[model samples]
Target: MKTNANAIAFIMEGRRQRFRRWILVTGSLAALACMLCCAMLLLGNTIYPVQEVIRALMGEQVKGVSFAVNTIRLPRMLAGLFAGFAFGIAGNTFQTMLRNPLANPNVIGITAGSSAAAVFCIVILHTSNTVVSIASVIAGLATVLFIYVLSRGRSFSIGRLILVGIGIQAMLNAVISYLLLVGDQQDIPAALRWLSGSLNGSQMDDLPYLAITVLIFAPVILMLGKHLSILELGEQSATTLGVNADMTRIALIFSSVCMIALATATTGPIAFVAFLSGPIAKRLVGVGFSNALPAGLVGVNLVLAADLIGQFAFEVRYPVGIITGILGAPYLIYLLIRMNRKGSL
Candidate 1:
């Protein structure tokens, strides 16, 4: 009786600690994201005061402030926030589910697929944004399916999936380059901007679908978080515990791909937000806690923050993707070295 009571108390204590940790990490990330969002709105060419920014957001007719805040800043900020959250969640889901940090959409060709479709539309077809977005989503799903088919032998192999994805990404990149070379020089600048992932010229009209995609799919992924955790316990163990690993993986991949594709369509695949958010969230939240929300928040922070730095950190402005790519490259190198050392490559 005494031992049982002690065990019960210990379990309760663990639950409490986990709850507290979740609140702390998530709360901090949320706060940082809010701060960055506000900064994105307020810190432009002519800095708007807080009250004026609020009035603009509230639909007031304050001439200059309203025009700047509502017409320009608000849409840009929303694009970064929503796209960042989607990228973060999707990337984190892939990495956590696959049990490999390098399994992010950015590294594994999912974003490349979306990019290829959008670039083809822009450079070859001269299509509308809606058409480009649809193409991107379809291409992303098809790429995932292709990778899965190629990687499947008798059972799923993470190594084969990643290798095949990398190869596909390379091929897609080559296609993008060829399109750029043969395409009209007048359109090359636009194509380059899209590839570099700029939030410039964001319109309020373009946000609804991306917002809806994240809203519908993010919850599904979050709801499956427990199953994802179970799957982390190896295939046989998960099967013995009555978790259908294949079904769960398919659901996760489908949901995550939808969110990622929409985000790439919206912001042109802002680099490294997906690849970096999960590890940062895990470090902050520690083990044995759900890092999904925190990871999303981290992504939001990274995108908004990188955009601000790109805009004002240097004399010449750079796109958000360039800054993030610069940040992610070092981490990628470090990861490769670490993996090589461990003979996990």
Candidate 2:
């Protein structure tokens, strides 16, 4: 009885520690994200004071501050914030569900599908932003469905799914290249810019859909966070734990794909935010809890910070995607090497 009591006490103590660590890390990430958001609004070409920024945000026209804050910086900051959160959370969901760090939308062709659709809209159809976004979302859903179908031949296999996704992504990327090659010179620039994943020229009118999608879907992901953790423990174990594995995975995948698709439409597939956010969040939060929120928060920081760095970090201004790509590529190489060493790749 005493030994059993001691074991229970030890388990409870471990839970308490994990919970505390999660809270501390998540709180820190949230606080940092907020700071980055503020920095995005404040430290643009003209460094407006916080008071002026506040007044500008509050609808008071403060001369030079109002137009810059309300028009340019506000929209840009919002795009980075919401889109970052969407990419972060959705990316984390995919990684967790697939139980592989490489199983992100970026790797598995979901973004490529959206990017291809959006590029087609820009290059071939010469469509409006609304058309591009809608097309991207539809294409993203279709791409995931196609990938799932191709990989689900007999049973669900992670290796098969990833391989199929990589193939699809390569094919879609080729399509994008062909579209770019044949596109009109004037339109090609626009398509190229979008493909690089920038926050420039972000408009207030274009934000509502992406924002609303994130707002509605993020909670669903969070609610299923526990199921996500269980689903990571293989199908049979998940079933044993009372988790409806298929239902949970379907829900998670659908929710994640939607948010990520919308984000891609809004920001043109911001490189590796999805791939990097999950592992970083999981590392920070440790075990025994869902890292979805932390992952999203980390994403927010990455987008906002990367945007800031692109704008001010160098002599020539770069797009957000370029910075993130530079940041993520090295990590990808490192992850591959480590996985290869462990014979897990």
Most accurate candidate by TM-score: 2
RMSD of each: 1.1, 0.9
Best by lDDT: 2
- Please write out the lDDT profile of model 1 over residues 162-209, one tens digit for every residue: 998999999999999999998888889998998899898898988999
Residue 307, model 2: lDDT of 97
- Tell me the tens digit of each residue's lDDT in model 2 across 1-345: 999999999999999999999999999999999999899889977898899999999999899999998899989999999999999999999998889999999999999999999999988898888898899989999999999999998888888999999999999999999999999889988788888999999999989999999999999999999999998888999999999998988888888888988899888999999999999998899999999999999999999999999999999999999999999999999999999999987
What are the models' TM-scores? 0.97, 0.98
lDDT at residue 293 of model 1 (Cα atoms): 85
Off by over 4 Å in 1: none
